[model samples]
Target: MIGVIGIIISLFLLMYLAYRGWSVILIAPVLACLAASFAIFDGGSFHMLATYTEKFMPALAGYIKAYFPMFLLGAVFGKVMDVSGSANAIAEFITTKIGKGKEIWAVVLSCAVITYGGVSLFVAAFAIYPIGAALFREADIPKRILPPAIALGAFTFTMTAIPGTPQIQNAIPMTFFGTDAFAAPILGIVAALIMLFGGMFWLTHVEKKAKAAGEGYGDHKNENLQIMDPQYLPSFVTSITPIIVVIVANFAFSKWILPSFDSSYLETDYDTSFKAVSGTWSLILALILGVALVILFNYKRFDKGVVECLKDGVQGSFLAVMNTASEVGYGNVIKTLAGFSLVAAGMLSISDNPLIGEAISSSVLAGITGSASGGLSIALATFSEQFIARASELGISPEVLHRVASVACGGLDTLPHNGAVITLLNVTGMTHKECYGNIGMCTVVIPAISCVAIIILGSMGIV
Candidate 1:
């Protein structure tokens, strides 16, 4: 009972502190240890220091070791895309084609494309936020809604619903379920469409209402978008080719190349197996190819040289990966407590259908953690074995489970404490009080509703 109370307290505490802008790296271990003390020692000495060092640190280190390569490559790829002006070029191309009256469509599609191609959410928002602002301004749309417009593309669908999206949220489930980024292709597509079209409808309605109320793009000074010089940008083909390279190469590697190689050497004394993680392996290759292409295609255009881009990317990956890794660590500690079994059992009892249980469990954790990948990683890492076994027992496909888990993780993760939401709001110079409502409608409400739809369709054996 005390242990269960600890888990409950820890989750809300973490959520509140994180929303207050505390670092998860610091908050996680402290709270994790506090939970451990209540569960592990009962009325005895809490041994807070020992629990922190023994349980929390190892989980953090282990996650870093397992996932560092993916993070590093992904960051560099996004950096190269941004630095080469490919991101901006592609964004402008989409909006230009869509034209001024359709600011929402242009920004949403542009952000979605870059994000689905594996760009960081921050980079996705940062890369095209100015364009979003300008388009909103030109179209006489409200500036306050820009974050959600940007989110509809980057946050809502591409992050989770799209099949083979190299987003970490998509990849995290693969290692656990022996699935891939393209898991449950039909289900993924359906969910993606629902999230995409459904979010579009809501935003379009909001834009119309705001427009009817006579709200124009407010007086926000957007230096990032304003300072971008058009002449130095890459052409459309050059801008999007790397994105294509990533997807094509990822498919080839995941479906053919990596599986052909023998990795029997990686299975001793570890719960992890390279055979199970081929999805991440493929994404690494995909990101690398994308990065190389960006550098190659834009060689002459690099203002600060490609080396600086590499450094920036490498530097950027550290905090992003560490933040998730620390959350994983905290979750790992939570599992060792007696309370977690009760928590897991309760969550698992949500439904006899494995997909329902998986989706609900993943979404709740993600909402609590305020991170998609972090929440997915923690849930899958801790309970994947159970999920897998149950799936097999119920004759449910792991691919379906994978798709459901990935999509569910994306839902509640956009809560105010979410890193991506916070960053997007800051980058666009809007407060949560101002724009978060729209952002939540697009990312949280719409995605959650989409996940439910997918689960229903999946339960009906719709592939």
Candidate 2:
């Protein structure tokens, strides 16, 4: 249909322009209007301005209302960790424990530890890059490998496949599936292992090939960001405690504490059920506790002043959340179109197995949007009801569905235009041409393989 062509054309333009580095916040609304413009020819009452105001704006506002707390708290938590030196200390300790002559492994593990501990992916990269670059340079490894090494740790398994991870990508699924963060624990572990080891093996092989050809760390100037001052940083114990606090607090709250709260009056008092909000509540409280502990442990070490640190984080949170919300708004507009019905029907028909269709739909949308959280949010918003119904009819657990959908979005979402990928490249001062191949192997190809493996395992009732 002409409308489907228009939608596809709009999507192509979105990706193309985004790949050229235009801001999605600037383009998403414009593209939403473009996609909706075709509806006028379909013999329907479609007002472009009305759709933007009524449908798109409401969807955007709703996402902000529901998720702004997590985004704000997460950015603040990551910021405090950075300013107080906790993130640097943790990365240093990890790299030190991994020892000398294995710089790539050290960088990967250092990044993995901090990001899995709930540090934002961007913060993890900024915190670990100086250390990783130093290690790679000392070990005579190619500097270009550093970004991919960091990407392997920060962007793949820890962000998606790991159980109990507090990343927003993982948290987004909880509300949709009415499942907690630790969904499909056994299957999550399997996928995590596949991405971690599989990625490491590829990196190791790349290292060996480069060494055989005598490729050494090339000369490159350090980025202008503030370098970590070891003298003022807290000890490893003080630095790591906050991360542990977040992990333990998240687990206890999600598993025990929040559930014990009396919400029986919700039918009369609040419109929502307890299960609908418990997962988000757990992460929010855990992040708050983590931020409080980070300050408590390093109260005097905030070189930028606590107010300034908080301001920077608050600013960052607004930008990050707005970008994703705009994409969600674009999706909301797309869903209202006549063409989207065809796309949804095709997605649902991908497999008799709901898991396969779920995986493919989430991954493709994520790839199209070039954002994991945005695409995952949109997919769940659009197809969650169908997935839930199909899954229930087929005897599939919602927990498995949660795990699959979470991991599925992560793979294609890291394509070159991804915000995180661009930030990683900028942090390391590396070009996509110089290192994106490695990044693709680690974050994209490997994660996809892991996702496929988990899909098979889920289909086999292994979850």
Candidate 3:
């Protein structure tokens, strides 16, 4: 009981301190030890230093070992896209076609198109914001609506529910489930359509109410807006080709290319099998191809030069991976406690359906951690075996489990403390009071609905 209290207290503090802007990399280890202190008092055998060194460090290092390439390549890919003006070019192409009067749709679709193409939501938000701001300003739409519009596209479907998205949220389940990015394709598409249309409907409704209320783009200074000159931007075709390369190359590698290779040497040489690592290998190769293609297509357009862009990307990946790795380490420490058995049992009892249990655990942890990937990683690392076993017992596919967990993490992860939500609001120069409710409507409420829909579909044997 005392140990359980410690786990609860550590989680609350983790959420609160993170919300207060403490770095997880700092807070996680401290909190893991805090929880361990309670475990020690509760008569559990855990040494704080040993736990940190033996348990936490191993978990953190293992995650980095497995995933650092994807993070590094993904960051570099996003940086190249941003610096080369491909992201802006794509956004401009979309918004220009949609035109000004349809500001909400234009903004959402612009963010969505680029995000679905494998750009980071942060990159998508930054690249699209200037154009989206200009559009909202011209259309007399409330500036506050812009963040949710961007969130609906970048943070929800494309981030999670969509098939073949290279977002780490979708990719995280692969190692655990032995699934690829396109897991449970039918259910993925179904949930994606729901998130797309449902979020669009809600944002459009918000636009209507704002129009009726006569609230124009609120008075605010849009400083450093930096809308790229259209002629300076790459052509739409050149801009979109790398994105297509990522998608097509990822599919090819995961489906046909990697499987054809005789990875028999993997078990002999590395003491692991090809099946265990192929999904990650596919993503790494695909992102490399994507990054190489981006440079090839826009080599001359790199204003800061290719090396600088690559350097920035490599630097950027370190923090992103370390933050999630810390959370993973924190979770690994928590699982070693005597209290965790009760917690595990309680999580499992959330529903008779293993899918529901998986979804709830993923969603709750993500909300607590304020990170979709962090939450998903912790939930899966700790509970995936049990989820797999229960799912198998019920004749469920790990593919459906993969898809459900991926989609569910995206649902609650947009809580007000989320970094992406905070950054989106900051970049758009909007207050949380002004924008977060609508952002919630799109990223939180709508995605939750889609999650429920997919879980139901999966339970109905639609997978």
Q: What is the TM-score of candidate 1?
A: 0.95
Root-mean-square deviation of every model: 2.0, 1.4, 1.4
Q: What is the lDDT of residue 185 in candidate 3?
A: 93
- Per residue, candidate 1 scores C-alpha lDDT tens digits across 1-463 of 8888888889889989988889998999999987887854455446787788888888889889868888888899899888889999999889889876788899899999998888888999988888887777777788888899898899878889888898888887887888878889899998889888988898889888977888877786644556367777899899999999898888888889998998776687555677587888898888988998899889987889888889999999999999999998898888888878888889989788888888888998899888888888888877777888887887778889899999999999999989888888888888999988888988999889889998998777776
Q: How accurate is candidate 2 locally (lDDT)?
A: 0.89
lDDT of 2 by residue, 305-366 (tens): 88999999999999999999999999999988999999988988978888988898889889
**Residue 428 error, candidate 3, Å:** 1.5
lDDT-wise, the better of 1 and 3 is 3
lDDT of 1 at 456: 91
Q: In candidate 1, where is summed lDDT lowest over 10 consecutive residues?
A: 39-48
Model 3: CA > 4 A from native: none
Q: Against the true structure, what is each candidate's TM-score?
A: 0.95, 0.97, 0.97
